[model samples]
Target chain A: MNLSRTKIGAILAAPTVVYMVIFFVVPSLILFSYSFWSSESYRVVPDFVFTNYLDSLHSAVFWKVTINAVRIGLTTAAISLVLAVPVGYYLVYVSRSQTMLYLILITWFSSYLVRIYAWRTLLGTNGVLNAVLLQLGIVDHPVDAFLFSSFAVTITLVHIYLPFCILLVTSSLSEIKPDLIDAARDLGTSSLGAFFRVIAPNAANGLAGAFMLTFILVAGDYVTPQMLGGSSGQTTGLLIADQFRKTGNWPLGAAQAFVMFVISIALYFILVSLGRATGLIVKRRTINPKGI
Target chain B: MRKIWSTEDILQLHLSRRVFLGGATALAGGVALGPFLPGSAHAAGGDLQIMAWEGWELSDELADWRTKNGVNVEVSAIGNQDDVTSKFSSGNPPPFDAAEYNQGYSDLYIDVLKITKPLDKAKIPNYSKENLFDVFYDKPTWYRDGKLHGVPYAWGLNALVYAPDKVEKPASYTDLLKPEFKGKIAIVDDTLATWPLAATLAGFGSKFPHLTKDEMASTFENLVKYRDQARVISLTYGDAVSLMVSGEVVAVLIGWTGIPVETAKQGLKTEYTIPKEGATTWCDAWFMPPSVDNEETSYKFINEAISPEIQAKVVTRNAAGVVSSKAVELLPPETKALFDYSDVNGIFKAAPLLGIPPLKSAEHATYADWVAAWNEFKAG
Candidate 1:
């Protein structure tokens, strides 16, 4: 018997589709349903109510933490991508050895908590950074601002996610042939101009995907921020986690999570639109049948 | 031999492979579900399962007792009070024979959720009026409805932890706000531990853990002052210890008694003091859930938990107060110096073990409200 390409593709994807439906889609739907419920005395009651969402919206603390999370997320993503693109370019276009990439991947073997604590030791008042500054007479005393601030949170996040972002960027750039960059340069485009005019627009979708993935991880991270962000580092993820862990208000936590999820989707769209508007992303043109 | 196999031979091979796969899958499923089966250890009361704080497992302390009793014990470390509550309330609850609940959470576990049942004091030989300190005996938190619901095991204080080298012993909580302590203080983000101190600072020490809405607001308003002085809001007791050890802050406002012990391990000397505004205290007790399977083993475990030898070991390791009066004689010099065993009643009067805010209240603030207030303070 003969089968169409689409049919073959569907058959190949069936297992993954079923797995996702069972594991992801069903759990997500249940969590979504829980957002509409209410809680009293640590017990979640099954009832349709919008009080959780409305209360979160009206609360000043909620807005404050949400905005703080967004700021940290966007800043970390921007820094990670900016730093990743150069290393990714070197690995894809300039280097033939896979050693550097292997080294980058090797960093993941270390525990995440260990990395966070390492950053704490490096940025603490009497840390290596302060010791160096003091030796060089950069300042009279250690800078307290080096840690337990939004800056510390963002810097630590950038370090943690940079390798991941670099891998994503390299994978995206590899799909664009180095020959395309050479051709652009031959047409009188400088190295920087070639990167912008030829490579970026072609790899726009992949780049945006990498940024959004990093942003979502950073924004939803409660642990790093709690460890480094101090009072200013309070984020929506921590608040939602507290609702479930401390307050036993699962429904309210679910509502806040869904709200953050919706915001993340909106941010993704906004980023894609901005890329197109700024000509960083090229639009595809279709041929008219009448003209043809 | 380069011989072509017949169709029947191929079909027979496929049938054998299918049978092997089916049998393996069934075996795996049975192994995974064995614990929940009726004849399994969990159901047959052959093993005792406990949910408790990390150190409360008493694996090292109870080794001999467990061996003598020929009992297999399983312990699950809990991150917070709600862990046990969430586990028991879930659709398929674990068969937890025993669990630990803080003093304040007894009401929620016993009265509201009904997750716990009255303990059979007759079975626990070590849990008695003569063995336990008078302060922990016949308490309203654990003893309710004319029945003992929990056995008091360990207790601790939430006071101001300070580095003696950098700062002198603060005479009052207000000293934390002095110019000398600027950028040298940390307030822990613990609502339950902070509430009593906040109440004291708000001039409502006598009515703590049960405050009207206006009083709750005043309590947090005072907490905000401490927050302003704090260089950072430590997320946990460990975080507070890290801050103190690193010398990032000279003092921790509303810190744990265990913080000094933790920091001392890192070569940092820190001490805690109950200021004029007083401090908050917590007592942990062992209780059996209603779904307990091995009641006999569970009672033995709870009784052994407060035994003099076991209590001494636990108090030393945890840097906490022991409920067993006899345990004091077995404590080491440094462990004995942690708390004044001679004046157990005086220590209770200085910082009483307070309850969590009422779960539901019309004229007063509830636990949920206190959580929200704590979150707001942390956000700032």
Candidate 2:
């Protein structure tokens, strides 16, 4: 049985493993190697130097923007998840809303570029929102004070990522035995208290997954911020883009990317640990010791 | 009202689901490997491919040739010079034979790859002594040493394309860069072509014969001041058109051939203006590939492209990209009058900014330094 299980796992995993080695691992290694190389105006010269790492770390602009990116990431993740949980719940639960739920899922089908372009049109100075407002006499001229600001960037990012958060939470909610939450109230815990003590813990794993999914999507995005961000709102992604295109500084771009990678990995582990401590992932060996 | 966690709370979901965890891990692994494999074998004598901006945007002649030659040619229309320069310099194996470039960018490639093969004077026989303007035909922009490095492919002016609403006087570059237009302006990003005109505006061009380093320094300073007042620095004609249509920018520094004519039908309030300092004029060449060895086919491609009939069709169908003298005769009597086909007489004579061609290498380095410095200055 053990041998059969091992064989099954390897057979299932071989394609992904081989695909990754060729596409991902090899390229990342090349980038890492180049990060240590010296870059001229447009060409890379292979001389070993730690200066790239030092330069990447030393820039206050780099660090400030990184922190701002993190702040935006957290705020976007939290707000998207917070809103998605209920909207998904209502669709999945009260709407008994399988049809609406399926319709909402259709949002995930639209291509990302179309969605970004649509959002840009809606939120731009002359976009659908401001255009309507002006026609309604709600405001006189176009209100650019809101468009292309960080608020607009974050709000648009949240709107884009909300569907992912809701889907993750609802799928995890689907797994819970509703009987346990009913029993807690059946034992005379108040409805709200039972939700807190019993049901919330049961669905913790889904929330963790939702957070991770939404967080990762917002972090690496280059388009929404690029189109929407005016002078004040440029991100590290834009800087990396300039390095490769405008400045032709690939080594520096690589080093800066590696820095982002380390931060993302660190954040990932922190979230994983916090999830475990909170029983977001209750050591599930007890729940499915043999079946899984 | 709700007793259960209600499928709605992200704060109450599980982690480490089987399929999603697996998908995330797999996706991350796939994205890490980049597009090109930097192996030794792939690097050697690789087919020199270019990604030009307007293979699709321009006329069908490029594709027509591919059919005739029976040699496979792959082309993608990346409609902007930023995309062109980025792709070429990006160290990617871009997919094309040659790209259409302006005088502004021909030097960038020369600086980077030096990958040009001189146009064989014998092969491109239509390249007569009398075809182009005297200054260029006597010594074309791409003419170096004794060999011609590029064929004259296209030419245009960086004249002002202004909205009649924005400017009462559209006759000078200095008038456009005023305080009232702080955030409502557009200009070309090329420093070499624009700076000599700025030097002329600052009266440095007149004093250059008795050239003083301090005078050149002041000219540079005045140009930097001009640079600061403009809001948008566009890299392509398409970008200029977009900004103009969006009403985001009022006046565009456009090549005369592209705007006030090529795109006026699109309902943009457009007029091409010659600055009081004259047009910052330029020319482009059909630069040859050092690695390209199909000499007979290459010559055929050049001669056929610049034939009188084809050149005339190009003036109507495409902008004035085809370089041939006979293109003038083919235009309607009235339309032809609008353009001066005398290469030197048309633009080169009308507004001559007589200034030094600062050493290309020194200019490239100094401008690059200035750009970086300007970015920092602007950020503040």
The TM-score leader among the candidates is 1
How much is the lDDT of residue A279 in candidate 1? 89
Error of 1 at A197 (Å): 1.0
**Model 1 off-target regions past 4 Å?**
A284-292, B1-47, B70-72
Q: How far in Å is the alpha carbon of A171 misplaced in model 1? A: 1.8
Chain A: TM-score in each model? 0.94, 0.82
Q: Give fnat of each prediction, in order.
A: 0.71, 0.17
**CA lDDT, every model vs. true structure:** 0.87, 0.62
- Across A55-111, the per-residue lDDT of candidate 1 in tens digits comes to 999989889899989989999999999999999999999994599999998888999
What DockQ does model 2 achieve? 0.11
A1-292, model 2: which lDDT tens digit per residue? 3568779999899999999999999999999998999777578889799888898798766776677667667778989988887776566445767777777778879887677657656765667888999999999998755554677778888878887787888887777666877788899999678766775676766776788778767877766654444443445665676667665678888898899888878987898788788765564545464666
Q: Candidate 1: what's its TM-score on chain B?
A: 0.84
- Give the C-alpha lDDT of model 1: 0.87
User: B1-380 in candidate 2: lDDT tens per residue?
Assistant: 85566554433444435557788887776566533434321122222234344522224654565565554444456544456557666555344445555565555566554656666787676677655444556454566678877666555556677777755655677776777666566655454355556557778654432334455556666765655555445545665665566665678654455655545667766767677776666565565555554445555555555666666665565444335665677766534654566554656666542322322233233433433433332232
Please list all clashing residue pairs in model 1, or write none if there are none.
none
